[model samples]
Target chain A: MNNRDPENSPVIRLSDICFSYPGGPEVLDHLHLNVYPGERIGILAPNGSGKTTLFHIIMGLLFPQAGTIEIFGEPVRTEKDFRDVRKNIGLLFQDADDQLFSPTVLEDVAFGPLNMGKAKQEALAISRQTLSFLGLSGFEDRITFKLSGGEKKLVSLATVLAMSPRVLLLDEPLTGLDQDTQGKLVSILSEIDLTYMMISHDIDFLEATAEKIYTMKDGKIMVDEGLYIHRHKHAHMLGNMPHRHE
Target chain B: MLDEPFASGNSVIHRLDPRFRVMAAIVYSFVVAIVYRFPALGLALGASLTMIGLAGLAPGRVFYRLLLVNGFVALFWVILPLTAGGEIVYQLGPLDIQKRGIVLAAQITLKSNAILMALIALTATMSFATLGHAMNQLKFPEKLVYLLLLTYRYIFVIEQEYKKILRAIKIRGFSPGTSLHCYKTYAYVIGMLFVRASARAERVYQAMRCRGFAGKFYSLAEFDSSRRNYVFTALMTLTAAGILYLEYLPK
Candidate 1:
């Protein structure tokens, strides 16, 4: 079925998605999510809350037991369908080690473009440009395994961005990053004009980046329209009243 | 911590085309392995050491590697002289050191050290990525080359994961002992590492697929064989031939 539509269609639409690992509890049960163009969506949840499962289902890495996933209004069911979908969707794995498999930073960034049928020289050019864009110009020959954590994370993002995907799926992009690097990343990400759905527990970061916040709980999602600040009624010391620090 | 010690050097040997270096190292090692006499073995060892010097690697590191190799070769000295029966060269109480056994042990030690030195001088100077590209250009098996690349890339990550698991175990008051419980705990640690590695592999593969990786790996690395590569290859080949001639010539 030719389901191609206009560019304004929702970039990703999941309907009644249900997924369960074999012999395990259901992680995503009859969940529905819609991501529109130019939307920076954030999914916040604690460990084991199935936020990553939702991202996997959207990216076609994990197939749901019962659901229909549509990308750009095109229904996806087979590996071929996912292949087409992946051309426009980039995924940044939680572990940079998992994503950056090539020996050097340049080759790792060039991998996506090369696999997408770019010529060797063209892929190299694109990889170089992306690395420079990410402020990693001198890291072309640096070994991926030898890089610092922040550098590796930036290289991983460069690898994804080299593909020029329309939508990005970032899983815990802020984990293990220091404050300075996080601020640098935030500025870099702010300058990019792309839709991204990030899964992170950093509320301040999500608030700073995402246009909409979502909380995943018990295989369901609830929209969090307000700030995620929590208030308590009691103080740490008994018989002491809570007071704000000046 | 298993890093290639001399990989980041900026010397003549380090700058040679990796394909030529790989080919020359293999040929030199074969020549070293066949040399039995002391003179030929010494010549080969001198050449290997000279090349290592040209590579500009720290002499201390080279000696450390040589010491590591000789530690294993030291075993031959103990076993061979006692086992092989020949004309007695030295006697200590109840044991005889045979003349032929001593010669054989020396030959083995010389050959092993020469080959090890040649490899350290030639192959270890290039980064792993350069070596992989060289292998690809030499028509090495694609699957093996890809596997090597992935293994080199992820080995450190797996090591870090193993360390994390060990730290977790230690925090829980686990200590190594000869008890059955300790053995079980160690086994569980190894088993957990394997499980985590397998899961990470799966995630890595998925990430690859997400980025349009089918099965075959396409590398953007390009290597040009310059005059330096040809000169290096010729020099290594002549040295190897010289070693072979000296080893097999009639006395």
Candidate 2:
């Protein structure tokens, strides 16, 4: 929500970024938005409105047809650039299957550590600690593939959270979760100091969770002190939703 | 499927390390394979299946899911004896039933059942990673071990994709008759499966990349499986080995 003062900037900046899938229409139009660290930013858009595409563009998973993404102070140059950047940020996909490919929960969470070349024992310890944090203490030995959808999502976050990332990018993470889990997630998001970028159409989601919001439409983003309700556009709700005090 | 005669109580047999059980079964089965005797193999087979019943790992459901996996092999075994050219035991109308066919069929059934049951008795309920650790302790080839492990990881996914294709076929009103169009659709489905699996592999690989995966797999084993445990396993393995030696041998 802090748009004017650059001195106390929460996060870095993103200038006019445009992206589209191969043979698909321009999903994310010329978009420009600034998100501060410690802010839960929700990108509210329709189903095919390129919400995920924009997130991917930020994560450097998908290169925008045109635009720049700056993290902190450095520009993300290539896939290698995103490697270190990823350590600072975690992207939790809508589908847990996309992230939790390991056979067991411990292995799944330890994946981030394994990537960092942490020793087997050390990785297991980190994973176990994270699991407990996510209230999955006894599930370390359980098979991740056999876990319930809600459990899978929890483990997926546990995997990323184990890394202690500076930013978290979540794509419709509350899709299949029950109300209890949704409530828990809201609290967890609030307590975390990392910058969070979420894509969801749940308007109440923005109000309850995000500190700042951005609406992406026609490849452009507009900022409002309050989340503006708009119809007929890709990114419809970006800006702040009557900012809540921490 | 119903009884678990192999699942002994929480006594010595139940508490015996799975590594010991696996080693014992493997060594015993190898001996039986070499001996090639009817009565001894039969007794060993009976003993193995009995142990699985005792261990109590049977799913005990309407659909014997594990049994379904061996269906194709069972069918092959059932048909093999009929197809073989051997001494005729009887005639079912005009069709000949060979003695060799029946005995060989029995052997096929017994050997596989014995090996699988023994393993099931020991490892069915044991965590797969624990089993992998056992195999690693046993000095199993790393590549072969992960081959089985990865296959287990992906089999459900393959089955699910196949189920989806079949559902699509049912919705399209596919008939039993193998017409050109039907065959074409089947081919398309198969092709689609391969493409989808490949793409999934790519995405998974990308995800792995995001997490810093460098083309290596790590097994985090918490089980305290050391030399001391193996010393105890050695005794169990020797006993199972003795049973096989006594049961199956060339005259």
Candidate 3:
């Protein structure tokens, strides 16, 4: 449904990216991906398929041996170059516990805005607003760890949203959520206006939330056309009877 | 599993600002620590008891905490009475119990209980996070405040990790025994916990950076002192002065 002209450049671009851990096999081997503005991209990959590694590299948390990274049409090279990148690009970690490190919910949610140099009052307002948007009103003074699993998940998302990032990199946002929470997350993700690149192994979840889907294999991602399920004739044990098989 | 169970309350002590609580706890603890005379010690202990009563803490829980402290103080009672050389009070089997030693041990017990009770009544009524924020507002070093807050935040997570590791071990048919294998396995478990903790710390740091954290921690906690806080201050001042007066009283 996007009617933007083709002349518009991608918001994030990674070309010829190669990364490997010390004393380990290559995790990302010359992978390439491009994400345009307002694009909701979903990536599907199994464990240890370099999906997380790719996002880390994109955010400059992990440096690739060889890659040219561009964000907002500028080449990112040094640590100074990545400062603006992290400020504008919010990376939601896989584990909610790792994100909500503050003692209270409001503190954790306000942390991002405060770090972005907003005044204390402004940050508090942003945190409250973000929590209210996530249907977490009146959770400001609640203990962070005392929250239920689903509530922690939403608060973690609030922490990222309070930064008002132009782009979001969500890592396995639906991993351990209950069915009800999963449904809530799907609706929330669909309603937000920001562009995001989410990686998860849940194919149905990807299809529901992402406009374009990609699958990862051998440290590389390829566009996923679709899964095909068709009928075929097969012989059963009962006197060569014909049956439909998938 | 780690929790601040006593932090939630609506008593007068709990309603007092945490900044006041922290400061009062510090001053009162110092006064009780230095006082040696029995009369002043008794007054201080009475004041601590009053504070505890005002806080409305559960008597059973408070007594349990005192029992734990006295368990450690029991050691002092055992050693000090025999070791200290003073006028002999009692004669045991080839051992003399000194009067000076008994008096010293009694003083220590009173001081320890008094300080501990005051701390529980003041600081324990507020969550650790509030205490940290109050310290920050009181001009404590920013780095120290951050350390306290971050430690309080992750202590629960680390405890959960510990439990998870223990459960994994139990699921593998491992049981605690006084054997070399059991000792080695326990050692390895602790080593694994440390390794996991360091790795988690790295990820937490990166997550903080992702949110644009740059060595700055801005707190949104606001501590407003009401008339109750002033009354608390006045009471604390009067208690301290009374204890001092009793200590320096003409004998």
For model 2, state the Cα shift of residue B241 in Å: 5.8
TM-score ranking, high to low:
3, 1, 2
Off by over 4 Å in 1: A1-7, A223-246
A200-229 per-residue lDDT for model 1 (tens digits): 989888877877778887787766556344
Question: Which model scores highest in lDDT?
Answer: 3
Q: Is candidate 2 or candidate 3 better by TM-score?
A: 3
Better of 2 and 3 by lDDT: 3
Clashing pairs in 3: none
DockQ of 3: 0.83
Query: What C-alpha lDDT, on a 0 to 100 scale, does residue A132 get in candidate 2?
Result: 89
Cα deviation of A219, candidate 2, in Å: 2.6
Predictions in order: lDDT: 0.88, 0.72, 0.90
TM-score of chain B of each: 0.96, 0.68, 0.96
- lDDT of the structure predicted as candidate 2: 0.72
Give the local distance difference test score of model 3.
0.90
Error of 1 at A43 (Å): 1.6
Name the 10 consecutive residues with the lowest summed lDDT in model 2 chain A: A230-239
Task: Pick out the ten consecutive residues of candidate 3 chain A with the lowest summed lDDT.
Answer: A227-236
Candidate 2 residue A93 Cα shift, in angstroms, is: 0.4
